[model samples]
Target: MSAKPFSQGVKSPIVHTPSSSSTTGPEQDERSTPTADLKSAHRKVDRRLVLWYSFVYLIMRIHVSNISNTAIINLEEGDGIKAQLGGLTSQQWAWVLSIFYYPYMLLEPFATLALKRFTPRLWMARIMVTWGIVSMCQGATVNYAGIMACRFFLGAAEAGFYPGVLYHFSFWFPTQRLSFRIVDPETAAFLSGPEREAIIADLPSRAPSMDSKTFDLDQIKAMFRNPTFVPFLVIWITHGIGGFGITFVLPTVIYELGISDTAISQLMTMPAYAAVFLILLTLGYFTHTKRLSPWVAGIGLEVAQIIFYILLITVDNATAKYIFVVIATAATQSFFPIIWPERIRATSGTTSAGLAIGITNGVTQLMGIVGPQVYQPKFGPSYRVSYSTSVGLLTATVATIGLTWLLVRRQDKRTEAAAIVESEGVGLPGEKDRTKQQGC
Candidate 1:
């Protein structure tokens, strides 16, 4: 019985299994992410980010687009009345629109730098509050100069909002998640609708009173530090130019196509309204289902806008021109939301994302100020100038998107390479032995 019991003693291995709680031994490296785990995380985050972004987009669209419409219409109305008072021309009207860019453009880089320090939420709230006040004030102007003053401040207030939002979207969606493209079209659509509404609201008989209010810069400064804004800058700038070209002249073009001012005003709003509805629907389904590439959707819409402008301008027939204007209006309005917030998301965290988005939006808006001038024509048909300018802008947007795609691809490769190098233990010169000694 004693001999039988002696045979069962177990032999121990040379290396002891390190206790889970022990920190003294080599730190265990976490294994690479499992494919299923990575995919699951991507899918889960994609749905949530898209859903949240879409909701925020809807709110913004209602406010910003309406402001854009009101600003231009008020400028036109003020100029019309001022022309009777001081005998000003359309060129001065163009200047009123163009001058809004000077301060707006100058502030963006500084704003961009500032985003490195703030949170997006605070920054956006500040921007919205200021612009909302300025937007309202455009209605109160009794003269062209007064309108001009309001427009200038309006530019200054809204400057950083779009870019900042773009920065916000970049955080939760990586390139593979396909959310970056989601920002622009949605934004365009939202802005377009309200713009149309403002146009309608300002009808010869029924315009709403506008107000000019002040906001706290301190709150804006606070949003500069929040980090989540990597994607916002590029996408915002890309689509910003396109938006300017469209918003600046789409109404005028519609008028040229034999549409009545009343009909044009009401019809123009439809494109933006439709776009908003579609964006909300698309974002809810696409972002949640992980079924759409924001880049593809955004670029495709931009291309459609360009084509619409080309068709509208080149066709000799009035009926065809009218048809194209409607089509272009509808299509162009869809890009804003998809592209805007996505830029902010790329920026990283919500705060920096906000700043980045604000900067991009602010800077790009300078294009809006400059746009009326560029398309206003020195001597002749401004319609031709406006439509052709839009073509150039849309082309640039496509190029910018191509560059962004490349950047995203390179980033993916670098991520993969770093992961591989980390796994291979190709430690730096003196670090290998140190790591071994530390049992890492």
Candidate 2:
């Protein structure tokens, strides 16, 4: 391939492989991997993105999950928030947990627009600083209402972090590497000019029509008309319910295991998150290697969690229950990385991708509100209501993902059929050429 010098901006490095029917020639095969330079550059990109952003992401999670951890904090002294804040009730604490999800869920989609306006560096720094202030104010709360207000503002302050980061990843990496990141070629000071140009040139141009900053409602409507849209949206909700739902209340769920040592119970929660990290690493590696279909892997993970939840509901032993929760949390959280890249790239245009990503990610936070409510005091001890509900939702997620895959597969067929017809009369039968940017 040869290209004249020009700036077309960057697109995803991953190729969106067409259906088998679209290509008969071996040269047009989907296995046209990146050059050694591109791969090496990607490794460097991966190191910086993973290490730097992981710390940034970790700090945000530490702040969010701190509220849950507080229930068990200073347990030996019996001086936790429950004791400090006029003997806050379990129900009120639940509300504190619940309130954060409201703004966090609602504002997620629009956050992408903010990402567009301010650019990632400025936007992220702005988010982190504001949320830090709000979080610090939370430590000074005197009463239930004071804490509630702090939590609300905290949520509002933290609204865009996850969505903003995901949008950043979508912008920088390919659909394939997305399972792995955000960096812009044009603006990256770390790379020399030739390397920057090489990185941009290596990106497979899926669609270059819409500007990164453009907001096109019609494209979003076109996204809605796509068969895969509703299913993917459903996926965001159900997965949140079944998977992240447990994640939200995991600290409490561990506390409920009749453990006498409150500190031990608090420490137990760490393992589940650790399990999530490990599982994601394992799942991400195999998916990146193209050995597993993300939808299939997601379904399998959901199925495993369903079994774990059932075991959780049935087990009377606290140790047994804790083990199940850790594994279940791992299974639940592991699949999102697998599906996120594919989900975003499936859209037709840039505008639709941003909006859909925002809306769907926001919807996933719905479980944060609903999860706390489901694990209310009334459902405790056995918590059959919560566990059973998770099983049903995981079941729904499996079905929804299957439906989405079929819908997208059918669309691929239609695209291939049209391409087959187009090729029959023109250049090469079964050849379906993708759109490439100018000067390439």
Candidate 3:
């Protein structure tokens, strides 16, 4: 073709195929692939969140499971109040044994609120050290009443740890990555990357980073607005009743295993450390991998407890019963760290993280109060009532899991549908665009 000449003398040459870098028509179509890549990048998990979550779960694993270990230790040593104090009966022993769950449950919800008010590291460390001291005190008690008082204080001091850790989990992980982030180390870290990014991205918006003495009030306010809060209150209530019920029977259960009281106490200690290690491993892996739901893992273990209880009751063979007991102990203990944090995050970012956890602790603590009373030897030595009560309470926990699952699933569907609509540049056909007019 002839080239176009100077001063519009000849017809202009026709443009052919556009270059790859063309800036003309259909530029929008060329941008679509890069847009998708950006979206995927936005969804990637952060690393720091995973590390933090694993650390918190580790602390909780030690805090919660150690109670059983210590009780077992005391039983093995024949260090129970009845052994130390004169004129004490099985019923009184049971009462003292069951007292710890009371304050622990009662304090959980409120403790969650406290998590919001203070720095998690400091507050959580304080609770842990206090409980550790209380546990040490239990070792020193001279009589039944003294042991009883120690158990009560132990409950009060330890009440906030699990829920506080959970509230911390929520602040970092989004729904897509929660269970995996908590249980699996690698995946959890992946999920936390975005969280760190958001904070770092906002550094310009915030005043220059300050010393530990200064706090971030804005982040604290974000917790209350978290939607997962209300449903978890009900979940924590069930956990309280179950934890106390089972704890009250542990010593007696050991007695039934055909072991001497001293040996039983020592054997129970094995599971406490076992729980800490197992939880750290499983949660660290599963959360990082994003393979399973923490709720599923926790509820599954509680349901498994029914089988163990049945084995303990039906198996006259001492060796078999002891084996089942060990298995049950490990499984049941693993759930606490996983469940509490998952629950708190559902309604997180409130100034009330500490208070919410504290309340949960208080309510669950009542299980301690009633559990020993119901299983007293005045009813019988075998204490079938205690085992049956545990079975029933665990069943209730399974039901709670199912209900909570359905509720969370519904919320997830809504969230997903909203996300899809936003990506597609469309509005909900019939429903009002509330997110458009009002901020989420």
Candidate 4:
């Protein structure tokens, strides 16, 4: 074998074995195997964690929302959950329903902070256990005040769980993967690693670095000032108001549509919820596979809801109305999953992201207060006013989303232009500028 020479200005000569194409060096083989194994292990663990948290979230939602069913049962004359306790008036019941949200809204921001101080596992467990206890206490309430107290405490206990899970997922996944909707390859190509890192680094932290500043008045102001943040607030609030308005009174609405039997009406709700779940799964899979824009999908669903609300208000056929109700439920419920990830992705850092998530959760839960008030007893049976109000809010949501899409497009253009300029500038030897090359 001849010795290969290395020139001062040139690289060393390359040597290739006859089997080089079929085999790797010992170091290369060793390095690749563990990395591949580690990735596979991580994926398995991620799937299990996602499934576990999803189940937890489902139970929490069911516990919080069962109050709506309880209220309707109490309204009925016969023996029911509400009748056995203390019977509450329409106005009084509204108060009971809305009170839970008061503490819920107030405590959410603080909960985000607590999640930062304590580990998510511990904090989330504490939230679930306490809320579960509060939920059980509701069964023992004797009067409006007792029920109200239980609801209030329940709200306080459950306040942070949803947002906490969101924050927890943000830690495990990149923003794109965290998003329920799919990202198109073109957009994916433009997303640079540093940009993603910057997004992650910006999340609000409990402990600020010696060189880094803490989340303060200025950062708060900056967050609100961010073009994307304000629109998210609007979208979340309107979505909450519209979504809860229908959901809280859904059982009653079904009963009013000539389903005289209470059990039948409750059972009827099951099919609608099941249909919505299937729609959500289908939409999630389709959007992910097709690389569809969540904004576009969300807007389309909101428009469908608007049409459904119109049909509910104007149509006379009971069967037809029932079908529309099911469609509307599925559409409205599916919209949140599409939009929420966008909100999380728009903000940077843990503190700002937490604040964004917290504020959005806290403010939107105010719908609990507004929702019951909208579907008052005065508008009973038909509840024309309630449907009309939902239509208006849904319309507003569409407009807000449109504005957000425009803003995002403008931002993308600016980013691309800036990257091009940076790449055009000269750089050090052997180092090609990747600003434009990365397409971000």
Give the candidate number with the greatest TM-score. 2
lDDT of 2 by residue, 1-440 (tens): 01111110111222232332121222224324666656766666666554656678778778777777777777678887778888987788778889988998888778755766666667777888999899889878899999999988888888877766665555445555555542465566666676666566644344322244357665656666666777888998888877787666667678877875677777888787788777777766676666766777788899999999999878789888888989988888777777776665565455665666677778888788887777775687788888899899889999998888786666555555544555566544333432111001
Question: How accurate locally, in lDDT, is each candidate?
Answer: 0.46, 0.66, 0.49, 0.62
| Residue 197 alpha-carbon offset, candidate 3, angstroms | 2.7
What is candidate 4's local distance difference test score?
0.62
The residue ranges of model 2 lying beyond 4 angstroms of the native Cα positions read 1-31, 75-78, 181-183, 207-213, 415-440
Task: Name the lDDT value of residue 192 in candidate 4.
Answer: 51
Give me candidate 4's TM-score against the actual structure.
0.78
Segments in model 1 whose C-alpha atoms lie over 4 Å from true places: 1-88, 109-125, 166-239, 283-290, 339-356, 377-382, 423-440
Cα RMSD of predicted structure 4: 13.3
Order of models, best lDDT first: 2, 4, 3, 1
Residue-by-residue lDDT tens digits, candidate 3, 1-440 = 00100000000000111111111123223332333323343344223334544565566555555544443345445664455665468677666657776677666666655544555546666787898798788777777778779978987887766555544443333322333343111123333555434522321111112121123354334433334444455565565555445554565566655556655455554664476466646764564344556667767777777788777667777667667667666666566556653443332223333344445445655656776676565554455666677677777778877776665454434544554575678888643342221110
Q: lDDT value for candidate 1?
A: 0.46
RMSD of 1: 18.3
Residue by residue across 59-102, what tens digits does model 4's lDDT show?
87788678777655634566665565565567887788799999
lDDT of 3 at 272: 40
Q: Model 3 residue 43 lDDT?
A: 45
Worst 10 residues of 1 by lDDT: 1-10
Task: Specify the highest-lDDT model's number.
Answer: 2
Clashes of 1: 80
Clashing pairs in 2: none
